[model samples]
Target: MTTQIDRLTTSGWSTCEPIAALVRSRGLPAITREYLLAEFSPETWERAEDATHALAKHFAGARFADEVEYGVLLVPDPHFLDTRRALPTELRGGDVVDERLPAGVALPATRPWQLVVSVIGSYGPSLGSYNEVTASDDFVVLGQDTRQWMTRQVWGARVLQCGATPPDCEHNERWTFTLFPGEELVDGQAESGTVLKGKVRFRLGKPNRGIGSARVAPALLIDVQ
Candidate 1:
């Protein structure tokens, strides 16, 4: 099977070359990032009218940043600990209609889609008031000229403390989504069968008294309908 990464590599677009490199990197074991990167065309980059403002809006004054280390190393999926969402159909649909549907709930006919990675962190001064901070990839949604996609915030995480730095803490969550078929990125041109893939990394600053911080690394894969 020629994977999404393969198609993107053969596309010969220089913009996707970095994504190819990341796919080739050994440290990361996942391949979803390649799909999103391949979908990112020069046109998409150009259409990002206010890049600075868009990014600022996404960050929302969060003073934390995450660096791409080795590969797109994300925390374990909220449910599976070390597993990622299943590929293909399962990620998008299922037999039963549960109470709360997962992020990438496939829609009927056609619809816009988005994959989001959210990071949340909180700190307390003397264990009383924990100031919360967060950052996420929804900024991409905000930058879009078209507001058609039914977006969802899939993954989130609290900063992981390497050691005993705080008196108390909580486990952060990381999520994944397989969006329905639609044109959220390509815009108007009707990229129905197009799948977009990309990763978002965010970090949060420490609190004043009680230590608090968080980071989220998300790789969102959308179906190229």
Candidate 2:
């Protein structure tokens, strides 16, 4: 229990793995803290296989081997619909006013800090299902399966604040929530790729009313532009 000269002392990388000899006997820094804590395997993925062809060409057709199968699925950065990125002053300019717009022209109103969005993995296994009947006056009917699993065009983040809001949001009462990134991107019933868009920051707390604003704290995806 006496080895912390700021880690990094695995004696020039060469693992026989006892967790790299217990992180080189606790002195730490064992192979640069096991690749800065990625803690790889598959025999340590050659320590990072030169980042698998640039993360497989930025996740093109994802579904690699050692990992990444229906993972890495972030969306919301389609240049933010290119309206100079401040959309939402009631949709400024392109104001067709929600007839699902697209008649003339004038489309730049999506602000709320562009509403935010992200996934970076997991566009699978969400399909839909939930049932519970009892009707005929006994009343119980629950039926669920709306079909927005994730991946269609890629837009549907909704977590506007825990269990549908109600004095919640203490970081979602510990279970935490916050997604924001919607307005378009939905075409992912499954089968499609590349959905990267970054720059995240949350630790929210103010704003209330069933959580209509200022609440973001569930993830921390940082500056990924």
Candidate 3:
């Protein structure tokens, strides 16, 4: 009995997992693994989600940062928290029309999907100039040539595998964050500016197989901020 929200979340997560897994791997101490291993509950997921955004905000600003020495470090960063609606499915002739369906509640064929991860201490000294966005493979890279990147890497290969064929050479690839201004090798040899804007860009990856398996998440461009 998949509830409406269940149908929405499960689908979105399936599409997001693979990409999220890879991006989440880039954190200083690593946190994505912990999230993946934990039980999948509405309460638990929400907690993890909030922590990601918090961490992002902590590290996103212009400042030096570090990690907590003990316990599973939980940070919140909206860039690391991906959420969107699910697509509509083919109705099997008869559908269950119930009280659960609110009056005039028009369910769209699809909803938004997201893939995000947070990192602490990733944007510090070593980050240098041009802003470095260190992210987990779990989070999708959303920027630059957004359309083309999605066409080949995500929509075509990552999501539409169809099971009959193997993953495309470009499918399930890792993310590469670009350093716009290029890291300043010298201490006092660079311009002063916010290296990291509201977002960063890179390729995306997948989650561990233990979770449900599916594909195709909502497309997010520069929305991580």
* Ranking of predictions according to TM-score: 1, 3, 2
Highest lDDT against the true fold, candidate? 1
Off by over 4 Å in 3: 1-39, 62-126, 129-225
Compared to the true structure, candidate 1 yields what TM-score?
0.25
**Which parts of model 2 are misplaced by more than 4 Å?**
1-109, 116-118, 126-225
Deviation of model 3 at 51, angstroms: 0.8
Model 2, global lDDT: 0.23
lDDT by candidate, in order shown: 0.25, 0.23, 0.24
Model 1 ranges with Cα > 4 A deviation: 1-41, 48-53, 57-60, 65-211, 215-225
Candidate 1 lDDT score relative to the true structure: 0.25
TM-score of each: 0.25, 0.17, 0.20
All models, RMSD in angstroms: 15.0, 20.8, 20.8
Q: What does candidate 2's lDDT look like per residue over 50-123, in tens digits?
A: 23233333334322222222111122233332221222332122211222222211112232111111222222
Lowest summed lDDT window (length 10), candidate 2 = 127-136
- Candidate 1 per-residue C-alpha lDDT over 1-225 given as tens digits, one digit per residue, 9 for 90 to 100: 233234223421213443224323424323354544554444432333233234334444333333111111123233322111222232222212222223332222221222222221122111111121111123243434211221222221111211111111232122221221121222211111111221222111122222222222222222223
- Of candidates 3 and 2, the better by lDDT: 3
